[model samples]
Target chain A: MLKILRKEIKAFLKDRRAVMLTFLMPTILITVFALAFGSGGGDDVHKIALLVCDQDKSEITKSTINDIDSVKMIEVIPCAYDTAIDLIKKGKRTSVLIFRKGFSDSVKNLHPLPLDFKYDAARVQETGILQSILPKALFSGTVGKLITKEYFGEKLNMLDSATRYKVFAALAFGGALSDNNGKDISPEKIMRVNSTSIIAAQVGNIGLVQAVAGTAVMMLLFSLTGMGGGLLDEKEQGTLKRLLYSPVHPSQILLGKMAASIIVAIFQLSIMFIFASLVFHLHIADKILPLTILIFATAVACSGFGVFLATLARSRSQLQGMSTLIILSMSVIGGSMVPIFLMPQWMQNVSVVSINYWSIQGFYDILWRQLPIGPLFLTKVGILLAIGITLTLIAFRFFRKNVMALE
Target chain B: MIEVKNIQKSYGEIKAVKGISFSIHTGECYGLLGPNGAGKSTTINMLSTLFPPDTGEITINGLNVKTSIEEIKKILGVVPQEIALYSNFTAWENMMFWGGLHSINKTDLTKKAEELLQLVGLSDRKDEKIKGYSGGMKRRINLACALLHTPKILLLDEPTVGVDPQSRNMIFELIEQLNKDGLTIIYTTHYMEEAERLCDRIGIIDSGVILAQGTLDELKRHSEIKDVIVVECSQTPDEAYLISKLNLNVKVTDHTVYIESNDSKKDLTRCVIGCSEAGYEIHHIDIQKANLENVFLKLTGKQLRD
Candidate 1:
């Protein structure tokens, strides 16, 4: 058994093109995912150009523009109404906010303001963000202007001494009320409350990790299919018969080939994981034990499927056709090419039968969902091991029945 | 030693081997000679323990081929008709791999591989990939791989087909040397000359049945066809008149006349006189003594290659 394994490994390593392809394919996949998912860091703040067409040149409108510009997420650009409309039509600006003439009086009288908003329909996400933020900005500016006018004189601006005194008085009143209520309020309490409310979300490049794991599993299967061609090649070359002429049993030959493919798959997945961690800063090493077990089980299952494919095919061309049809379909349906959530519900339910589905889900559990090492993780591992063992037995039975009978 | 008794195999409705039986002594080169599709490979396959015979028994060294295949495989080397080495591996690597399969230790396998490579005159090219080697070189390595374990019995099925003359002679010499060293060999080929030169006994098979089996001289003596006479005439001869005048079995094709005769000298003289009396001029006359080809023709009424 060891001799056969050693020979198989030597033959695999000698094929330079195959070795290079195993690593090159995953690298390309990681790069494409990084580019598609916006660097995978999850911290990318989208900047949309917002054109403000202030028809009412009141102090309230100016204050509204300042408030909108204070948000780092949206860039505010002041333009004429006609120019803003032209820019929106030309698709240069995603959204335009218009302030009407009676906007300041409406706020002072506590009436609804006539605000007109125009957005480019093509930029749906940007338009949505702008629409959500515009209402809050307008209301805050209107209410602040009303408060300033009521507390201070109409001639006093927002930054005047009287307005500042009012703000100080309000803060002092709030503090005294808190003390009278027997509840001590301080800066530290506020800071502590703010910090406690901020949850520690799942860290690391989730998109990059998913991409690496998905592509790694899919490519691992592809590589196994290619490696499985060795079986047919040996039969054609008569080497399989020669091997049988030795003291080794036929099962040992099949085991040797499967062992080689499993090793290759494991090696491929490890390289992809390491590359993702080093280049994209993914947190693959956080749960190293579970991750390693998942990778091993995935490799075993895929390698078994590869052997099954090889035994089912009668020729090299047949193996090629079957592998293309099966691997691609599984990859597509199992969320390697597209996310499972994007797939139809029926298709997602059907994807449970695919090996890629279990592998990708297992990886997501560890790297993205950050599920603790528990039954969820063990369940994935169990399914993969079951798949590997079951498929391998089928392959062995078929091989013994069909291939071993060849003269 | 190997023994086969009434081995028969069939594929669905087609019978491939029909109750064939043979045996090889401890140190004899036995040849199974036949045309294509003659079940020679099937018989070799059965003896090699590749597959069990449908309704017969085979044993090697007193071990049943069906129940004792593992023990049988340890003592048999099969060099198939096809070149079976991994093309991507060097010749040395191929030898090592095949040798390792028999559980040969690394040091001994390496040493034996070197010795075999030297014997096949491929020692200088052992490190070259099999794909880069010529057809003859590949054939030589194929033979070398089978001999790695030094099995007691070697089953070679058309091992020299498509090989160049140099390699063919080299293979013949190698087989002869191995046989001289007490290796029992079962060589199958359609080439009569190879069988005549190498085999201690030849089994003439056709259409999945053994027509005859014996030494070359014994087969010749047993056959009625002692010699074949061919006469080239200047003009087409009348077939009816020639047969009437000579009162002998004669077949005329175009301007040539063919006759299978037990007495070459007497028949040639009679043919010359008979043709002269019939006003036919003889351009040339040739005579061939009885050999394996003629013996096969006499027994089966078909050429060995047919």
Candidate 2:
């Protein structure tokens, strides 16, 4: 076994790419993702400026301005139709509302409606807000028309008292709203908050961040299984046999191979964590040490699992195939690809046994939420450590049973 | 220093090495000679303690392979047919690590690895990756890796099989020198010439059985023919048919022909008479004794190529 292990280490040294894949590549990716894509605080909200053009100077047009700015949620600026259109086309403003000529006169006369509003069809958000406020603005315009027709009934053209009474009612309300300028009350408003629970702003969804980072880290660790191929390559060359001709048992070979893989995994995880903290602004809070320990244990177990896989595999290609199936399954079930909590309830039930789930979950608890590390968290850590140890033992035993023929 | 009595190994229904027995005395270069697929490797693998034979009682320097694999491993060096050295590593690095496997102390390992590298005529290329080395250079490094621990017995399985003549000669010389230094060597090869030149005692094994085992001279003495007659001819010549027409005791190849018999003079006189009647051209003939190929043919009644 010692013979096989030495040969495996030498083989790994021969493949510089394997070493890089094992350690450096992960470090580079983690750092790049964390630093380049990292943004702290809540995600940036979309900003839009709404511009209004009143080509017609009328009470109906003025009420439209009031309706647009009534919510005070968006900034509304009054400008010429051409200026507003150019600003919107240039993206200086996201939307422009234009009220054409004869809008107020046509509404007051109560003949065929002559009001027209033009807006950018491409501005989805602005268009939606504008659509919601259209009814309020039109109602306000109608009230202005009713007032003018009723107060000036004898001075103008009105035939029935029923219509006269209706005009009086409209004038009574419109007179108050008109003198107050274009500031009118809107019947519609938007509300955008729904949360069953809320955490502090400093954390900034730490659990989700950890889940994504941890998944990447664990999947990258699977490449260490290439060390098994190193073993098979040596055996083919007869270097393996030369090693086995020594006074060493096969267990020693497994131990050495596992050692190299674990070291690589450790380096990989540390790189990700450091990059996450320094570049991505991932908060470790007071649980940095515990998270580091958790990552270390995960690496150890996974590397041992890699060696065991190498032992069972007949060839390098076979080992790769097996490693893919095994590592991916663990990651998927463990919440490396998807957070275990987000998975279906049945899948979550399955994740309790997954190595990735435990490793990723532990990291999230330690780094993101900054919750206390009491006995419950301690038990989860214990389970992870136990799993790592068990895999090592089984893998070592497998090497002992089969490595005799390596020579 | 190696002995086997009734060793048998099988893979499922296929019998790889069937009830074979042989021995290699201390300081003796023993050869296991056979054609391809004759189970020479199966026999050697068992002797190396790589895996135990299914039915066997074997001893290496008084240590049984089945019961004392650890002891057997300590006293033997193995060079497999394939070049096992890592091309990515320097020749010296390969040797050092292999030596380390035997628990050789770090200080001793460095000195020993350097010596083996130098011996293989690769002292200058010791630090270069074996990947760039020629086939012969890699073979030399392979031998170097095996010798790192300086095992008393060397089990080399066709170490010079695919090398050029120069490299093959170098390997043979190295093996001879190692034997001179009191190393017991068990060399296996399909090349009969290698066995003839390198082995002190040769075992002709075919079909998992030893057909003959003795010194070269002793085995040659068993051949009835003392001389071979040569009849050089063109590759397209109908020599076999012409010889059969004459009813002469003769065998013809594209390059030469052999007329083997105790009465060479009488046979030649009859051959001239028969050839004259057939009107076939007569080529000069000189008789000579049989070599290993002929001896194999005489014993098996089948060509070695066949």
Candidate 3:
């Protein structure tokens, strides 16, 4: 047993690629996961941006904005109402807070405040966090005003009889919202929060849509990389030379493999979505056209990545080592393992470099956001195609220079 | 016809084929006989246009190898030293895949694949995956895949390595028939007998150089000895003493004395007398006509297997 163990150790050490990857894989994974999940680092915190449209322009509105912005995890950007709505429509901002014209007056007269909070329904996690934070900020702004009699007397003198009558009715409303002690009214009643989605989800669950898209792209990336290993196998078996010995060019062989891989990727994604639809009630049939196009574009990109990896490595073991490290790292950074929003702000910036980010985002637009086939959707498809084409070109060049050169 | 003019290939500091030059005529069976790492495969690779030489030229049938690689590929078939067939694929499937690379249509490719399988004597097992095949069977199929396009020239790099004798002979006969049908062939092997049996002309290469190349008779002259007298004895004779006494080249290995002879009759008589006088008891005596092995040994001062 000792002798066998020694022999195994020697053999393992001899395969430098395997040994290097054995150590490298875990080190890289732990580092990435720690960077993604660890806290206490100031820059690592993902500050959720809240767009504030303060039409009231009152002391109360200013206090509300300051209180919300004081939180370490939220950044308040004051903008006009039109600008806030535009930003939400264009997907520039996930959440928005609107203080209508009569917000400050209503607060003083003990009337229901006209405060509107709108968020993108697709970003359920981000909105949920925002929803929890928004109330505390509003309550803090109202607490100081409610504690002083001068705050109520000032608004009471400016009101007419008809308005005062309404104020009495509003006071009755506020009385019912208060707790048994009557001093501690809930944050919901304090601001009369009118929360709604800027763009509502067409699907039943946004999380399921996220799961189907994320898993599909991530798994396809892995499978396509494995398919790339076929190139190394041909090289080892000397079948690559046999193919080269034919009238075919090196580029043709690489492109042929890429094409086959793309077809397989498309098939893989189709099956994943079909399974998702049948079992999980994902509304894929309604968005079949866009989904098909997205899958094809994604497949092209992933197949390119696969061929690139195959051409990059000299042997099957090396390819295995490299593909595992690359695919896993990309999957994690690209929001396949976890949502990009949940990661550090820096990681979210880095996620755009990964192919998974674009592919998964494209699916989210169709399934979760129910986005139409417009410029935004086309841009995603274009980026994926560009990535695929560029990777294929690099793979071709590598095959010609390194592989076909017959070192 | 193929012409290789001082074609040199190098990988970094190691010159794989150092300015080696040779030519093959139409319908000629030319052999490159060398030990392992003797530039045989490098020369074949250059001729096949797998890569271009650093500073030389190769022309195949009036097309430059560097510029007209695709044209050359159309007429050349290569059987690499390693088994190049896809193991997961059956003999028929591998043939079809290779044949299809030549842009051969389905009907003709199908016909050609069947014919090649039949030629390799693997028609019955055409549908069997190659991984299940013996070394010889895989080799046979490896050769067959190259011939599906009916290339004018075939390059076989040690085609019979690790093959059983039966399959080796079968491969030999198949190559012989291909040559007889007027296909140009460049066969490389360390096995002198295979070269002697198949090639019309053979080139003996060593250390990235063609040490000697010619017809069998011409190469045999390099030995300068007509025959070798092998005397297995209880005690070996000193090589230097035997060489001086018998006036011939002598090599003593173990309990055997090998005497190279220009004149077998006179030389053999002198060898016997010399060994007797030297007190070496001869257990057996055998005479071998100087073949390529002896010629190779005489030139390189090492055994072919070395």
Candidate 4:
């Protein structure tokens, strides 16, 4: 076994081109993916410039402008209606909000306050943010003004009939002074606390991590398949027969080849991850141990898969075809090429059978979800190991029967 | 010593080796001489334990090949027909790897590998990758790799195929030297001259069966056409006249007349005298002994190279 291992290692080392290509390929792939996916930093806030055309010029319109400006992500710019339209047309501002005339009087008279918005539909993120926050800002601005009016202790008889009617109408709709219970409601007691159950974890550059891990796994399979061709090469060169003639069992030869592939895979993965960490700042250092274990398990599983392909193929060309078909299919369906979440639920479920699925999911746990190294990590590692051991056993059985039998 | 008894092997419906048997003594070089597809490699493969025989048994140095393959492997060295090398690796590395497989100690393996490389005239080029070496150099390394463990028996299957004459001669010299050093060898080749020059005993097989097996002289005696004499005539001779005059197996082609006889010397003189008296000028007379080629043709009714 050691002899075979030494020979395999020596052969690979001597082939400088193969070694260079093995390491260089993943670097190129990661670079391409990072450039394509655009570093999913998730840190940059979308800035939407809102041009407000206050035709009403009423206190209500001013308060609404302030409410919109209060949100840190949206910047409010007051301008004339024509200027706002011209700015939106020139792409200077992402959106424009127009408060029609009688906006305050309409609210006071229990009539609908007309507000119009013109936005850049091309800017999806900015448009989405504006669409969600604009309505809430408007509603909150109206309610805040009505509460201010009630705090002044002004009676309805002191104001005009239309004004009085609008104030009561605004209060009725705002739920601050609803008469359903026939009790006066205090705005201070109506607490507006914003809370979220989702805690933000320090997952650095998710897009870059996914790109690194996905490309690493895919290239691991590609490189291991190429390594598996060594078996066919030996058979063709008659070195396999020579090894069999030695004082060793056939299983030793299989084991030695598999070990060599696994070692090369681990080396390939290490170089890629180190490159990713240095260049892209992938946050693997926080969970290094589990990450290492997952990488090792993935390497083993991929190596075993390579052996199975080699043993199953009768010729190098056959191996080439089969490996390309299987590896590319697995990469496509296993969230290496496209995220599993983006795929249909059925396709995502089907991807569970792919080794890359488990490998990439394990990496996601460590690098993205920041899940602790617990049952989830163990399950992924165990499944990968089981796949490796089982496939390796099947490969050995085929080798013993087909290759070692001198077929 | 190696012994094989009625070893038969078949692939699908084709019988590759049909119950053939042979043995090699402790220090003798035995050759399996036949045409292509005559089961020469199959027989060698069986002896090397590359595959198990369908029937019968093979024992090397008193170890049964079926039950004691590991023990048999310890005493046997196989040089396949192909180069069977990792071309990317240096010659020294290849030798070291094969030696390591036999569990040779590292120190001794290095020494042995170096010595064998020197013997094969590759010591200076040992550090170079085999892919850069010439065909002859590759052949030399192939032989060196087999001899690293210093096995008692060496099985070379057509080692000289596709090699240049210079390398072929070098291989011949190497095999002779190893045999002189008291190593048993089993050589398989389709080249009759290689068998004739090297093997102490030759076995001629065809279509998975051995037609004959014996020493050079013994095989000649088995041939019905014992000797072949060629007479080159200055003038074209009539086939019928030459046949009638010599009263022996005579054939005329172009300007030469061939005669086959049990006694070559006597027949040569008679043919020369008869051709001279008959006014046919005999420019040259050549006498040749019956070789493996003729023996193969006579026994199998086909040329050895066919």
Candidate 5:
């Protein structure tokens, strides 16, 4: 038994790929997770730039902006309303806070504050973060004391005795009367936040959109690479040599693998979207044509990436280890695992090179931005197709010089 | 016809094929007989255009391998030593895939796949996945895959390795039939019997060189070792006694004595009389003719299997 154990151990140790993967996978995963988590909520690491158009320019709006900036996670950038709008439209900015033109008279006289919050619909996570923080920044501390005095001291005193008692009872009861227990206490009315999604105005649920697109993009890459590993499997089985023996160019074989992977990826993406639509009520019918094109381009890029990685590795196990490490790293940095806004600036910059980033971005344009098939949308698709073509060309060269040599 | 002229291949410092040349007439089954690592597969790989030789040239049907590899591929089918197949795919599916690679149309591919599977005697089990196939079954499918294109030339590299006797015979019969149908063949095997049974002419190769090439009779005629006469005695005798009595080249192992003779009939009479006069009871006498094994032994100084 000990002899067998020693032999098995020696065999396992001899397989350098397996040994490297055994230790490397966990180490890399832990490092990636650490980087994402460390930068995810840290104030210094991931600072969300909040574009502010101080149209009011009042003492109160200025103070409100100052309060928002005081929060460690937000960086306040003051720009003109039109500039902020342009930035948001171009996807350079996630959210923009606008203090609409109003005299300081409203806050002094205890009237409703005029404010408008506009954000990119695709950056739904950023929207939620701003929503939670903006209210606290607006209503907390000195601002909250003044608003509470006017909101309750003036309005409640004006109510009739019986109505006031009923209102107080409902507020104290805290069940089924949370909304009706008070007058004009809803978040929208309190902040006068006419929140508008400058892009994809019709998109209802951005969470489900991101979930579908992000998971689909990441999963598509995983499956495509797995399929690409078939190339190495063929080499091992000697079928690749047989194929080379036939009257087919080497590029044709690589292209055939890419084409198969693309077909499978498209089917996988379509099925996932269909399931998302059925189960999660994701709206797909209106944008089906653009979505299909985006899916096709994404598939092409991912399949190319898969084939390229296949050519890089000498065997199937090596491909598996290398692809898993690469795809997971790409997923994390590319905003599939973590929202791009939550990642460090450097990681976001690095993500532009990953296939997952382009794929997810293309899906976002179709589903979240709802941008028509215009220059912006086509550019994303074009980049994906270009990446696919470039990787495929490189893979072809490698296949000819290395794989066909059969050394 | 195929002409290999002074072809040499090297993998870094290891010279696999060192400036070897041979010619094959159309429809001739030429065997490359060698032990493992004797460059047989390397030569076949070069012939199949899997890789190019480091120097010299190969021309098939008057077309140079360097410029006409694509054209050559259309006419060449290679059955490698390893069973080159997709185990997850059925035998039928594997044939269709290879057929597709050969640019065969779907209609013809279907017809050819059916025909080849039938020829391989696996038509009934064509739908079963190859992962579950026995070694012999996979070997049959491996051969069948190569024939899907109906090429003019076939290269069989140790195709019968690890196969049972029944399947080996089946493969031999299939190869014979294909050759008879005017398909030129290049067969590489370490098994002398396989080469003797299949090859019209044989090339004995070892250590990256062709030691000799000829017909079986011619190879035997050229061997250094002559006919062997064996005299098995009832009791063991010392070598000195046999050598002193016979005064011939005799080797004694246990109770048997082997005598090399130019004339076996004359030597056998002298050996029997010598053994009897030396008080050694001759139990049996047999004469063995020069065979390919002996020829290989005389040339390489090692057994064929070694």
Candidate 6:
């Protein structure tokens, strides 16, 4: 077995295609994506620039100006109203904000009125997302803006048009979001939302990694089915008969072939590991015992499936066709292409039968989640073992029925 | 020595080898001759313990091929009709792999491989990958791999098919040399000439049955060629004119003459002085008889290759 493995590894190394597939191209893919990720690609908080046009520069206007800059989604750009509008029209800025001259005087005096502002819709849709966020944000931001109007400081609480309009707007638009429990919304709440992202970001990335790596590994099993073709190639060449006549059991030949395949599968598996680590930053820790078990079982499943595919096929072309169909269908239905959560409930329920899904879920609970140590040690390991054993036995039995008798 | 006794194999009632039996003694080459689908491969496969014969026994030196398969394997070499070699591996590597399969050690395996490559005259090309080698080179490598571990019995299935004549002759010489070294060989081929030149015994198998089996001369006796005599005379005669005038059963070519007659002495003595005067130097008188090729034809109802 060791000898077989050594030969297989040498052969794999000699193959330029495997080298390109396993190492070089994946490095390129990882480098490309990592640079893309760090740069935020096209859309993110870092790249947004906002413009504000204040026709009325007053204390209230200054306060509103301060309010506009507080939001993280926009980077403030000061400009004349016309210039701001022109910037929005030219796609130079994401959006522009305008405050008319009487906006502050009307609010300080006992005036019964409200203000309205307008801007280009095209910029808002394509480039002006940050501009439209300011008006409602400015209004909703001031805890004192919606307080009942006080007449002459006697606190004869009055409901004026401006306050009325604000109340009416709150009732109309913010009903779904209102914490009727009267919980005062604060910056702490906002900070909590942002900080929770550390864990969420980790989970999200690990999930994506598991999803992608699981698929690559599962499909890679198909590539190693070429190992089985070694047998068919030998048989086609009549070397199989020669080997049979030698002082070796036909079983030993099968053993050598399987050994060679497992070695190749190991090569492919390590490629997957490095790829996931580099591209997705797949986290592996000291829980290598479980990792080792998962890798071993996965190797078993792939090698067995390879032998099974080889036996199922009578020729190289037949193996190619049959394995292609089998591995592809399995990968698709098993959630290798898409997350099972994204599937309909019925489809998700059906995914339990998919080996890739179970293996992925096992990986999620183990490598991705790093969850409760109990589930990691027992359930995940058990399920992976079950899938691996069941699939291997199935493949072996199918091979015996189809190909062993072929000899 | 190898023994196959009434071996039979079938594939869903399509009897591939129908109760055929043959044995080869030590240091002898036994040829299995038949056409395509004649059960030659099926019989050989069963004897090699690849497929169990449905109802009989094959004993290689007292080891039943069915039960003692591993032991049988340990003592046998098989050269398949098609060069069974990993095209990606060099000749030395392939030999090492096959040698390793039989549990030969690294040092000994390399030594044996080198010697075998030298024996096959592929020593210089031993390090080159089989994929780049010619068909003959690949076949020779295949033979080398088979000969690893020095099996007592060698099974060759059409070892030379579509090979250049020089390579084929080299392979033939290799087989003879191996047989001389006490390896019992079961050689199969459709080439009647191969059997004629190499095999001490020949089995004429057809349609899953051995229709005839014996020494080359014994099988030839089964055919109706009772006599054959060739005369090397002192003179080149008008062979056709002499045949017409004397009413002789004669076949004449160049400086040689042939006759199939009940009384050889009368025909030869009468023609001797006349042929001598025609100025043909007498090299020698030679009389050769029919052999396995004739018996194979008579039984198969066709020539060997046809």
Which candidate has the top score in DockQ? 3
Q: Using lDDT, give the best candidate's number.
A: 3
Error of 2 at B30 (Å): 0.4
Cα RMSD, each candidate: 15.1, 17.1, 5.6, 14.6, 5.2, 15.4
DockQ, per-model, please? 0.54, 0.37, 0.77, 0.55, 0.67, 0.44
Candidate 4 residue lDDT tens string, B1-306: 788999899989999999988888999999999999999999988888888899999988888888888888888899988898999999988998989999999999999998888888888999999999998889988988999889999999999988888888989999999999999999999898999999999998899998778898888887664788999999888878778888898888899988888888778788888898879887888888888888888889888766
Q: B79-133, model 2: which lDDT tens digit per residue?
A: 8878877778877777877788888999899888878777878888888888998
Q: lDDT for each of the candidates? A: 0.78, 0.65, 0.83, 0.78, 0.83, 0.65
Candidate 6 collision pairs = A94-A128, A123-A128, A239-B84, A247-B73, A247-B74, B234-B280, B235-B275, B235-B280
Q: lDDT by residue for model 6 over B122-155, one digit each (tens)?
A: 9998889999988787777778888889888888
Candidate 3 matches the true fold with a TM-score of: 0.88
| Model 4 residue A281 CA deviation in Å | 1.0
Candidate 3 CAPRI level: medium
User: Which lDDT value does model 2 have at A39?
Assistant: 26
Give the share of true interchain contacts found in each model. Answer: 0.91, 0.77, 0.91, 0.89, 0.86, 0.86
> What shift in Å separates residue B202 of candidate 5 from its native position after superposition?
2.3
**Candidate 3 chain A weakest lDDT stretch, 10 residues:** A172-181
Ranking by lDDT: 3, 5, 4, 1, 2, 6
- Which of 1 and 6 is the better model by TM-score? 1
- Residue A221 lDDT (model 2): 49
Task: Supply candidate 1's per-residue lDDT for B46.
Answer: 87
Off by over 4 Å in 3: A1-15, A40-44, A142-179, A182-190, B229-260, B263-285
**lDDT (tens digit, per residue) of candidate 2 on A98-202:** 555765664555443333344433333355554444434434445443534533445434324434333332332222222222123210111010111111223
In model 5, which residue pairs have backbone atoms overlapping below 3 Å? none
lDDT of 4 by residue, A32-129 (tens): 44432332244534345777888999888887788888886677889898887665543345567777887777656544455566654333345556
lDDT of 5 by residue, B11-108 (tens): 88999899899999999999999999899989998998878888999999898888889899999989988889888999888888888887889999
The alpha-carbon deviation from the true structure for residue B209 of candidate 6, after best TM-score superposition, in angstroms, is 2.4
Q: Local error of candidate 3 at A48, Å?
A: 1.3
**TM-score winner between candidates 2 and 4:** 4
